[model samples]
Target: MGLVAINLLGGVLASLAFAFVELRPSLPFLFLTTLLVGLILGGWAATSSPLAKLYGGALTTFLILFGTGLSPLPASTPESFSTRIGFVLFALAYTLCMTALLWRAGRAAENSRMA
Candidate 1:
């Protein structure tokens, strides 16, 4: 319950900050911000979960950094094929990372409770 609320709040705040600062409305930006937020909030959730005990905080940190932080926008320019590929890869990776982290955290929390 608390994890869900924290995740939602963090995602909303990150997205709002990006939208206002960038002054542009784009799906990719929203996705990236939300994923980053999830990674952060998910890490907090992990401390109470079994996975954190097994994998430790670094795994959570890596999951956040690699999963949400490796956006390809910095690697690509606007007027090139690479830009398109970068955007696609960024979107896919962001979505996958968020999904995986959330699933892992939730499962771990449930497992810890069961144990």
Candidate 2:
């Protein structure tokens, strides 16, 4: 619950920042809000929901893209092959980082339990 609220706040702030910066005109920073919200919710749900917990990373990313697609952006932004590739690369990196951190934390907890 707390995480959800924090996520919401962060999403709103990022959205505002994008709007203030006028990112890409048609596709603004509101797109990031969806990604951030999805990541947070997916992560939280994955902790207790067996389905989400099993495929949290993929599900979270899909949700993000879906949310972005539903946004009121133009029919087509200034997207190109390179930009799309960059987005995928960044998403992969972000997911890997999150997974690594979670793995380390789990290991630390297990060690403490054994101790």
Candidate 3:
């Protein structure tokens, strides 16, 4: 539940940052909010155990990537090719991380049963 709240806060901060950029094209240092959001997410990731941290990191990356793709950024604003590539790469990485985490968790559970 705390992780979910952190993720939601990060997402909201990200959305606000993007909206600010869209509304004030002339503003400088618009990335500060985004940077803060990253820090929050980093803290969240750091709170978990090693394997769980990897899962959390991958989950966060996947959510950010997929969320950006789905966000209602102005229709007039076109997505660059590199952004698309990033989305795909993160999706694949997330899948692999999830698989590994699940395997590790299952192995631990089995070992506990055998013990």
The candidate that achieves the highest TM-score relative to the unseen native structure: 3
True-vs-predicted CA distance for residue 22, candidate 2, Å: 30
Q: Summarize candidate 3's per-residue lDDT along 1-115 as a digit string, tens digits.
A: 3443334443444445555556765435445544555565566677756544544554574457434643557643326323643555565567668878999999999999999
Question: What are the lDDT figures for the candidates, one per model?
Answer: 0.49, 0.50, 0.54
Each model's total of backbone clashes:
0, 0, 0
lDDT of 1 by residue, 6-82 (tens): 33343334334444425664668656755665566566557866544433333333343333433545543223333
Clashes of 1: 0
Candidate 2: give the clashing pairs. none
Query: Which has the better TM-score: candidate 1, or candidate 2?
Result: 2
TM-score for model 2? Answer: 0.33
Worst 10 residues of 3 by lDDT: 76-85
- Model 1: per-residue Cα lDDT at residue 40: 60
Q: Would you estimate the TM-scores of all the predictions?
A: 0.29, 0.33, 0.34
User: Least lDDT summed over 10 consecutive residues: which range in candidate 2?
Assistant: 76-85
Off by over 4 Å in 1: 1-80
